[model samples]
Target: MNIMSPPPRKLGRIHVPAVTLAHGGGGKAMKDLIDDVFVSAFATDTPRALEDQARFDLAALAAHGDRLAFTTDSFVVDPLFFPGGDIGKLAVFGTVNDLAVGGAKPLYLSCAVVIEEGLKIEELRRVAQSMAAAARRAGVTIVTGDTKVVQRGACDKLFITTTGVGVIPAGVELAIGGIRPGDGILVNGLLGDHGAAILAARGDLALETEIESDCAPLHGLIDAVLKAAPATRTIRDATRGGIATVLNEMAEASGVAIEIDEAATPLREEVRGFCEILGLDPLYLANEGKIVLAVPPAEIQAALAAMRAHPLGACAMLVGHAHAGEQGRVTIQTAFGGKRIVDMLVGEQLPRIC
Candidate 1:
């Protein structure tokens, strides 16, 4: 007589309305929470086994590139939900963008969440579903994750940490040190939208304006730039410190002076107004879906064209150029026919921004 193996175990389910200490007790309750919230949301072809790790085909990964790019970031933005994106979406794109800026093709992500006790189960489910949707949009997979519940007040309502892995294609190498004098500086789109949106979402200022966060995955836009201008020098995402920070970093790293035309910098009217009223510089404000890059003057046009061709880069513009001067100095040519130094931020203008 032939013998048969036992069937695979089914994923557990949650019955509680809100998370509790029992869910983090490493028993049936914990398993149920993971299965119902994360597994169900990030479900894919792989078997939902209670394995300690996720696996991938080595050969398949090798096909995309010669080197691996790995990055991790934690999101603790105030207001779990916000205009244009939420903490979950920010977590996914934030990690994905980190890999993309390094010339990597983002592939997989590992999501870990710390949920405070008493958070509604529905809220947790919503975040998980958001992450799944963002991963799909970025053409990546949520391969593995962990969940934890902390006592009330021990943590925020929710915090998400996503670790990403991508493959950097062969023949592609980018670094800030590659920047040279006369290289043209470029940015993908309007600045400070994310910062302004977050401020408005907080309701602390009692200021109101229609500005949405510019959170987005940028691998596609970066790939287009590379294909169009093979000689592009480097790219850096303008995140917490925004484009001003990125430019200062590139200048310091490459030992070059950089100057930008304030008139050329793109800004949504709402964001510009928001910054003016709050006495904040748009250049120093945070952005989630913007990039600062240097392209050889010879290929600037091509790079600009490629960037403008993509939806994310529709407002791409050449804002500055590196030149020989006081090394690591960055200045902006004011729209009013004056110039001033653009220095690194002393402290965060907006705390808990992302």
Candidate 2:
């Protein structure tokens, strides 16, 4: 009998472990994954059956009936080390911004670590120290945690998952679906820098400028804007799928069509050059430390003024507006005045992007 050749040592058609494309397609795949992973990971002692947001006993939270905000994320970006920040800083900024963008004053964070065997303890210390420093800057604390170790290759160098809790004052409310026709869409400065910086560091290709990731914490900027104009109805950090996907989310949630001016969305010169060279849309690239805001037509000026005062918001600009529709469509006008539909992104990160 002829010996069977070891299945030709090769790469698979696709890489990375993730739910199917339909997972982000708003289907059973999405719901099941949320129910299984998200609820299970977070709802150990709390009820997992029903609730739009996690329900907590306020009796223990503080004195008065204060509104509570909770947010969580997993950091698994390649190269625990990156240009502007690392996994540690990302852990803190990522969660702090989540709370801040939603109009909440962040209070505390819970960090969990999964480490690979054979990793250096000193490296672990450095990441942890960075986390401590970041938490201090964000004015939050790492209140609790759990640690787990796996055999080498069973995990990456490290992975950090953080959950944040904050309180929102009365009269302050924002929702993804809060977008409306005539509402102005604004984005805080320079897109694609964070994502492209990571790609460049991989050294797979050479580019003109040695760019740095725009990874940052946006709490300060958000704080300034909300203070100036309380009418800000929505805030979203343009992560995962970037501005286009985020705008699409706004359109769906508010049941309105969003119209964006391609020329108005800001892109750094190097970022624009790299995206153009590689045929990528600056709109769909991820940003670690940026924000997208939707506010009333009348409050646009105040919003801009407030944002411009904060260093992070200096480059902020109005990027779009909403229109009447079945509540979930997004359109963008090209520089030449052509209209195009912006769809939700699907599949493993295309284009070695952020």
Model 2, range 96-157, lDDT digits (tens) per residue?
Answer: 99998888888888887776755664566567777877887888866666556566687777
Supply the global lDDT for candidate 1: 0.93
At residue 111, give the lDDT of candidate 2.
81
Please state the error at residue 261 of candidate 2 in Å.
Answer: 0.8
Residue 235, model 2: Cα distance from true site in angstroms: 0.4
Stretches off by above 4 angstroms in model 1 are 1-8, 206-208
Q: In model 1, state the lDDT of residue 55.
A: 87
Misplaced by over 4 Å in model 2 are: 1-65, 350-354
Cα lDDT tens digits for candidate 1, 126-170: 999999999999999998888889999999899899999999999
lDDT, candidate 2, at 233: 85
